[model samples]
Target: MQLNWDSTEELRQAIHTYIDFYNNHRIKMGLKRQLWNIVL
Candidate 1:
């Protein structure tokens, strides 16, 4: 995806947002052997 960020601050914010998602809200796997399915 192309981010139409017009300034350095916008790019910084986008990177920070992605970092927060990577740390918190994305996904996880347990020892029970569960799988994730993506539905379009």
Candidate 2:
């Protein structure tokens, strides 16, 4: 996949969004768990 960002902030935000989804919302089938589990 190829992506072009207009600015550094846009690229940072995109990475942050992906990390948030990976840690919180995305489920890892191999691990059978979220990458990061938060208890609050």
Candidate 3:
């Protein structure tokens, strides 16, 4: 993926959003449909 951000805050926000999705919204088939934070 190619991303262009004007400032550090924008990059930080993008990373935070991706992490939130990965931890809270994404499903893990290998873990039997559970979120990452729940497993942690």
User: Each candidate: what lDDT?
Assistant: 0.67, 0.73, 0.77
After superposition of all CA atoms, the RMSD between model 2 and the true structure is 7.6
Per-residue lDDT over 1-40 for candidate 3, one digit per residue giving the tens place of the 0 to 100 score: 9778999999999999999888764445536644565877
Q: After superposition, how far is residue 11 of candidate 1 from its true place, in Å?
A: 0.2
What would the TM-scores of all predictions be? 0.52, 0.57, 0.55
Query: 3-40 in candidate 2: lDDT tens per residue?
Result: 99999999999999999888764445534444334331
| Total clashes in model 1, counting residue pairs 3 or more apart in sequence or in different chains | 0
Question: How should the candidates be ordered by TM-score, best one leading?
Answer: 2, 3, 1
- The superposed Cα distance between candidate 2 and the true structure at residue 38, in angstroms, equals 18
Clashes of each: 0, 0, 0
Off by over 4 Å in 2: 26-40
Locate the minimum summed-lDDT window of 10 residues in model 1.
31-40
Write model 1 residue lDDT over 1-40, tens digit each, in one string.
8668799999999899999878664444332234434321
Worst 10 residues of 2 by lDDT: 31-40
In model 3, the clashing pairs are none
